[model samples]
Structure formats: C-alpha cells, structure tokens
Target: MITENQIHSLAKRWEIDQITVMREYLQILFLFYLYAQRKSDKIFFKGGTAIRFLFGSFRFSEDLDFTGTLESDEIIGLFNNACSDLNREIPAVEMENFKKKRNSIVSRIRYTPKPDTYPLGIHLEISIRERPITKAASHIETLLPVSPYPVVTHLESEEIMAEKIRALLKRAKGRDLFDLWYLLTKEVKLNWDMVKKKMEFYNDAATLTDLVSAVKAFNQKKLFDDLAKFLPRAQRKTIPGLKENILEKLGRFAVT
Candidate 1:
C-alpha cells in the first residue's frame, strides 16, 4: 500500500491534485498486479493514458485503456484476481462494480480512506479484440521513478500514434485532437501503414485530406469546454486558442 505521505509527495512532484495522484497510484498498483499474475503479456496498453505513462505526454488521463485478445470470462477473472490482490495490499481499495459488455469490460473501483468523505472512484476499460493489428509491443518504464516494478509491455509509440489518428477521425472528443497535436509537436512519426489498416478495419475510406477537413469543422467552443477539465488551472486558459493552433499545424503533418 502506498502511504498518503508518499502519494502527496508524488502529487507535489507531478504538480497535480492529490486525487489525480491517487488515481495514478492505483493505476500503477493495478499494473503491478497484472504483472504478478502474468496476465500482462495478454494485454496491449494504448490510448491517452498509455501516451502519458509510456511516452511522457503532458496531458493527464483518467481511465486506463487496453486492447487484448482474452475472452470475457478470462478478462473478468483476471480483473477479479487483480482487484483481490490490490485489496490485499490496500484494504481501502474495493472493486465496486464489474460490468461485462459485448466488446469491453468496465470495472469501477472505489477507494474509501475515511468514513467522513465520499470514496474516490476510478474506471478501467478493457476492449476485447481478436488481437492487435500491429504486434509492436515493447517493455517500457513508467513515470514513477521510485517504483521497482517490472517494465510494462505496451504498444510501440508509432502504433499508439496511429491509433490516436484513428481516434481523431472516429470520435468528436477534443482529447484526441489534443493528443495528436502533442504527438506531432514531438515529431513522432505516424505509422501511415498502420493507420490505413485501422481505417480498413472500420471500413472507413476517409483520407488524410478528409480527416483534415473534419478537424477544421470541429466546434472550437465545445472543444475548449470539453478539454478544460483535464488541464491544469494555468493551462486551462489556453484552450480557447488550441483549436486554431491545431488546425494551423494539422496540414504540416497530415501527409501521405
């Protein structure tokens, strides 16, 4: 169990709120649990959380996302075991709900430290797929420097970027745009072959030009409002201009 003091220290070091720090703490704990049960090999981490934890993206993510080939029963069992292990380590943590959907398993966890306050909840979403389109997995270290846990196996950065591009075209959420912008700014090359493959999977024939046009039509006000909650207070004020900036830079990298 990570002590409150240690979590506070980490929050200070990361310059984020204590609740966000605790969420990340639990995420690491869950990752360690998966490693302990050897189920880590069956899953491939992706999405915004992976971008932050694995590749040092500046934006903070709430849910932990993964794509794995495991069956629902197997994934549920694995999560059950992981939750049991997490509870054994930190009795305050509890798995409140486990809902099995057609293509995903959603787990809601609650951390109840005191009787006076409401428990903090965190959500983990695991998408059950046949397998990763790109088998580009690698072992990588997490951002937590003091932890001695084994390296996590996740999708490679380029593959993650491709997925981010897929997400940008598929969803209206502002975070996808933000993530793509960050990846492009870092000069991370997008794997166009993988991107095309993902598009084929969805039966979408949208080209780079089409995607750029869609991005240009995004409602800036809605984007600003949607992304404001995830950013730090100092950064929140800049969201109003983020849409324009992203559109201006979109042309530079949205190339074949």
Candidate 2:
C-alpha cells in the first residue's frame, strides 16, 4: 500500500506527472498481487509495458499486455484474488468489469483514491490463445520508484524486440515503429529465429522481403497522429522525420 504523498514524491523524482506515477503504482501493485497468487509463472509479460518496465524503454504504456495458456475460469480467479488483495492496500481499487473473448480476456480496473473524484481506469489484456515461442530467460525482479516490491517476471529483451517486429508488420500504430527505432538505436539485436516462429504462429510468411514490404506500406501520418500524445515536447520535433528514420533503421534489419 502506498500513500498519496509517496506517489507524489515518486512523480517528482521521476519528473513525470502524478497521474502517470499513480498508474505505474497501480501496475506495480497488480504485478505484485499476480505474482503472489502464483500467476506470474503462467504468463509472460510482453508488449510496450514490458519494454518500459523491464527493459527501460522511455515511452509510457497505457495498458498491461500478456500472453499465456490459461483457461478463462482460472484467469478470472487470478484477477479476483489480485483485486481482493489490492483492496487491502488501497480500498478504492476494484475490478469494474471483465469480458471473455474467443482468444482473449479484456478486464477493466478502476482506481479511485478520492471519494468525490472519478476513478482512473486501466485495461489489462490477456491473450490466452497464444503462448510465448521463446521463453523468458528467468523471472527477473525489477524495482520501481514508487513501490518497494519488485515486478517479478518479464519476457526476454530479444523476444520483446522480435514481437515488436511482428507488430510493426501487422499493426499501423506509431508506437510499434517508435519502439523498434528505440530498441535498434540501443543496438538490441532482433532474434530473427524467434521472429520467424511468431510469424508462423500468426500464419504470416516471415521473410526479410515481406518485412520490407510491410515497412514500405506503413502510413506515416497515421503513426504520427497515434503517437503524438505520448511523445515529449523535445522528442516531438523528430516526428516529421520519424517515418524516414524508422524505415532506414528497419532496412538494416531486413538482411540480418
């Protein structure tokens, strides 16, 4: 359990706004509860959040994304237990709603610390149908600024980069492009072998040529619009040339 002052202090230290800090705090709390319930072993954390929390990507993520092989009933129990345990620390935390889709579970969580104010919502998406092709190296523990407990398990960086590549080919979101550019700039090598396995699972043919074609067809304007809000004022200057920069960096990976 964290107090409002603690959250504020963390936000100050990070030089980010309080809401962002609070959201991250809630994310940490959820991760703690999930691990405590022994659900961490069942699923491997992935997507932008994983990149941010585990690998130190600067971009902020709005939702928690994961993939695993767990039944609906079991996942629900995990969430129920997590929410119940979380409430002990922060009474305002609640599981607002959860819907079971064919291949995923979309859950809405509300955190409202103040009585008169509206609650902040965070979505947790669990892809139950697909499991990780490349397993994480281990359950690595990470410390956050706001929380004392460490986020226990996260997928490997190479695996995350591979998934980002897959997402770049499949989705038009700018964050995917931005994440790839950031990872590559940091010299994180893509696991081409794992990328092929993930592509096969999605029934998409994986090849350097195919990836290049996808990058060539990406909508630069749409990517800019989708990612504008998330970028800092200084970083926003690069948006005009982001498409070209991303395409250039992506070209390097096409052969290797």
Cα lDDT listed for each candidate: 0.74, 0.74
lDDT of 1: 0.74
Question: How much does each candidate deviate from the true structure in C-alpha RMSD?
Answer: 2.5, 2.8
| Cα lDDT of model 2 by residue, 94-160, tens digit | 9967788987898878988789998887788888887766555333244344344545555677778
For residue 33, model 1's alpha carbon misses the true position, in angstroms, by 1.0
lDDT of 2: 0.74
In terms of lDDT, the poorest run of 10 residues in model 1 is: 137-146
TM-score of model 1 vs. true structure: 0.87
Tens-place lDDT digits, model 1, residues 76-182 = 77777888888998888888667877767888878888888898887788878535765454444555532666456677777777778887788868888887777
Q: Per-residue error at 134 for model 2, in Å?
A: 2.6
